[model samples]
Target: MEKVSFVIDDALAFIVRAPLVTPFRISTGQHDELENVFIRLHASDGACGFGEAAVATHITGETVAETLENLQSAASALRGRRITDPAAVCREFAPAFADNHAALAALEMALLDLSSRVQGIPLYRLFTPIAGQPRLTFKTDITVVIGSVEEARATARRFAQRGFDSFKIKIGKDEEQDLQRVLAVREMAPGCTLILDANMGFSAQRMLAFLDRLDAGGARPLLLEQPVPKQDWEGLAAITAALEGSGTLVCADESVGSLASARRAVETNAVSAINIKFMKSGILEGVEIARLAAANGKRLMLGAMMESALAITASAHFAAGLGCFDFIDLDTTFFLKGDLSRSPYLDDSGRFDLTGAGSGIGVVPELP
Candidate 1:
């Protein structure tokens, strides 16, 4: 086993123009551009692995300063360790930061990226065996942020023309306004799958009323994500039951942050699906949570947090192995200025294909 050592080379923060298709508003922001944080981890062998922490202080309470502090602290613990096994490295460094999942995820991802590079195999191939190479298809949802009904309808029409069949609209700002927006979107793109992500901006009663309005408007959503607060398991369950068989499934994104929370949600039947994100639960932990969701008979959706190409590619590698997620939202990199890499994973239809021949994510050109 090679004695693994890593150095925290540089941390870069960039303000990216993440314009929503509509004015996206959650409990977090009404009109905001995404602030992305990128961490670079360099191994002793000159192999570098990158990790991303897209911060939304209002959503996850993780600020750039706090994330950097946690990464620095975790980086110290990761030095001079023989990390021949990526999964073992994750296990070893996970507890170092106590309950800081975001920081721990950064460390684990760097180690995995290094390990795959060392073995001369892509991270997806390292994780699972491919039988029949399937074309990795992902359903990216066009975001409809809080906006006027006419704006929402126009946005829906634009996305429909772009061949996106799924739409995730931000709701819970106003009952009448949101209903109009939903109705307008439905009218514009009647065939597209609709998803509502409230981002915990509504109370249980308000959420129920909104769901009721959706039902009455004949605008059934494919899923409702984080309608209420994360801790309101009872409310989530009630909403789930109320929407049972209404062609509107409920998925938990903020609530299912950890494996334990996923298990709890499964035990209490709080959601119909789990939204798995590498940004939230690291790649390895996200994989474990996906397996747990599979075992518990809950479908999974690999979600993203406005990451760069490196992080999004890493996530695509992970998602390639999991053949169960009914939906995928890996379009974060598409919104970047330029992917900071050469030879990025590109498919025929702009989706990433993981079956190509290469090692350590297949492409590690100098950061562009």
Candidate 2:
């Protein structure tokens, strides 16, 4: 008798620059075109899986060049490894990018995808068994990029027309301007779930002051994300503590890069919730952070970088399998002018049909 080994026979990395439906502005910068890196891995039996990573220098300090370089370097070592054990796949190549989570995430996702496809199971089932569940689908919020009040209002209306009720508004440019933009959206659509993402743009004092006004108005948003800089753990804690009684809950995004960073943010009481992005924290470590969030009574926001449908769909599968995320922002694909791949899990309604069966992430990468 001979033992079979799950050997990865080949690996390839490539980049695709996807244009946004409209100019997207966060506090740190504006993006009309998003450069994304994608990976494909093949097993000895010819089974292949695809993964994606989007670079945002402000969030992950990774550019298209760096992501591809890191992916290529890691892919070289991964080509000949047996991936029956997924954790080992991460351990082998994660070091290529000590601080480059986006690149590492792409590699980790590809390996996970490849392994599951060989076994002919959806990607999430690899993390946890989905033996008995009502359904696996999830609803996600749409993001409204930083813009004028009217522009924000129009964007809100557009998504709402598409049957979306949750919206994440990008802020951190100007305090007053940001507030007015939120108010504009709120006034236009009072019943929608509103999330304000500062993207680490506000000063501690300014953030606190603005929250105070929102609280007084009795319309503080459902959440505030990375109000201050990522390094300002004390500031994050102060804001979270201040909003304890009855105000917008604070969530950390940029502050969480890996399992250590996510754990530290929770230990320091930085925020009430943590935004877990696969691009900022690869799937392997991101799951650990999700466990951390669950144990600490911290809320989870399953988010994504500016990648296409493939990456966001992978993130969604993880979220559905975990069954613990309180919020979902896997809406980056909603803005993509064209999908690098098609995701069967997602529909125009911004929902994931997790019950849909197949192999891997239920995505087919369409590269030009």
Best-matching candidate per TM-score: 2
lDDT of 1 by residue, 1-368 (tens): 23434443433222333443223355456435545555455666677665656665666767767777777665665565445566776787777645456666666666677766766666666555222443354545667777778878987887677777777887877768889998898998888788888878787788878778788888978888888889999988998898787777789999988888999999999999899986677667787788888888887777776555666677777777555677776665444443342226753224556656466655442432
Q: Cα deviation in Å at residue 110, candidate 1?
A: 1.8
How many Å off is the CA of 216 in candidate 2?
Answer: 4.5
Each candidate structure's TM-score, on Cα atoms with residue i matched to residue i, is 0.84, 0.94
> Which residue pairs overlap in candidate 2's backbone?
none
Q: What overall lDDT goes with each candidate model?
A: 0.68, 0.80
Per-structure clash totals for the candidates: 5, 0
| TM match of model 1 to true structure | 0.84
lDDT tens per residue, model 2, 7-73: 8888888887777788778988877877888888888898887878778886566788888988887
Off by over 4 Å in 2: 1-5, 129-135, 216-218
- What's the CA RMSD of model 2 in angstroms? 2.7
